[model samples]
Target: MDITGAAAVVTGGASGIGAATVRMLAARGAKVVVADLNEAAGVALAREVGGSFVKVDVTSTEDLVAAVDEAESLGPVRVLVNSAGIGWAQRTVGRDGRYASAADLDAFKRVVAINLVGTYDAIRLAATAMSRTEPLDTGERGAIVNLSSVAAFDGQIGQAAYSASKGGVVGMTLPVARDLAAIGVRVNTVAPGLVDTPIYGEGEASEAFKANLAQGVLFPKRLGGPSEIASMIVEAVTNSYLNAETIRVDGGIRMQPK
Candidate 1:
């Protein structure tokens, strides 16, 4: 919907793609709330953008609900970007030199809990608040943009847990859109491939790693930037007709099998 004067909440707004979206949203005149576990970065970004910051753990119902309430105080939450997530690179079968063993259950569960289930938790609650909101001019209540990864489609050698967690986000997009269609709320996902987020390294990725990730990219021949993904998210939220879809922001790269 209209970004101007709209209240928006962005989980994982401390840095990376979430931070980029928050900046873009603020520039468009949306009243934003930075929701993330990183207090210093979140608060600093909020200050820079003239928005509020809420320390949130996506897995906590209370935290997610509280963020929704915080945004409501600014205005009806008309824009939501669920960008909070954790990543792991663990093979399903562990190596013990002579033999392989099953993966660690806790590691797998942790990834799913935050990246998958946590997304659902935030969306379910935020949509509840959005449902009560009066529809905008285009009959839109709000829009939700969830983050997934290209790994969901083509995971690397040790990314089983990460892939499964993100794949769930991709899987639920259509159903979520259908479920919220009656309320005029749209749901969509963006699965980015090999983004240059902090996850890779603080500044520049190693030459070898960058080359490896960029192997199949058609033109750019480099890692996608956070701003690129953020732009897609903002565009999706503003465009009322786009719904129940997962857009791949990869540079035409189908990740190679590891």
Candidate 2:
């Protein structure tokens, strides 16, 4: 599970948590492949890390397949990070008189497809490629770290779709880990609390929201840093004993209805 000189693929590597992960992996001597929908950002990030970029839409199987191929060509892909996901904040029925119609259902489906199905697709494809590689000293052929959210367990009022998708991810971790056991590949997830990622506004969150989030945190009464999540990911990958688990990197803050 040592990432040193290993080839790693990180989806949604253009910005936010994904970008932080890309940098962390690269710093650890992993030859990373940045897979993202943003071509320019992906390329720029890859260049900064001295890695490679593969433009990919995680919702498309073809795009994911191609990304895997490109990563494999670089070297053995021993690490896979699923960080690409979309968050939606619409109630099933809005007070503004917007009913949850066919279009709303379709939009929800799209979110699920991108966040859950897409993550599964990338994991399966990347794991298949990793299985073909020889095992390392730790008897580990590869490791996959999936990104989930605290909302999976503690959803806010308007986060139905986003929470459902993330909940699915949390549910899948154990079984996928069991399935990949024989191949020496480990699967795990990280459910983060409110982090200062782009998912929250570009800058700091609104004062009221920030205060609310920090209400019950044990320490650091503020949003988490992207590097904090990245650190856990690196640890999970490097520690072969860790598998089939979803660790919460939140500051002990379980969100509630505002």
Q: In terms of lDDT, which candidate is strongest?
A: 1
lDDT tens per residue, model 2, 78-133: 99999999888876775656454323787789889999999999999999999999
Off by over 4 Å in 1: 97-101, 202-208
Q: Give lDDT: candidate 1, residue 35.
A: 96
Measured with C-alpha atoms, the lDDT of residue 161 in candidate 1 is 91
Q: Please give the RMSD of candidate 1 to the true structure.
A: 1.8
| TM-score of each predicted structure versus truth | 0.95, 0.93
- TM-score attained by model 1: 0.95
Candidate number of the best TM-score = 1
TM-score of 2: 0.93
Which parts of model 2 have CA positions greater than 4 angstroms off? 96-103, 202-212
Q: What is the C-alpha lDDT of each candidate?
A: 0.91, 0.89
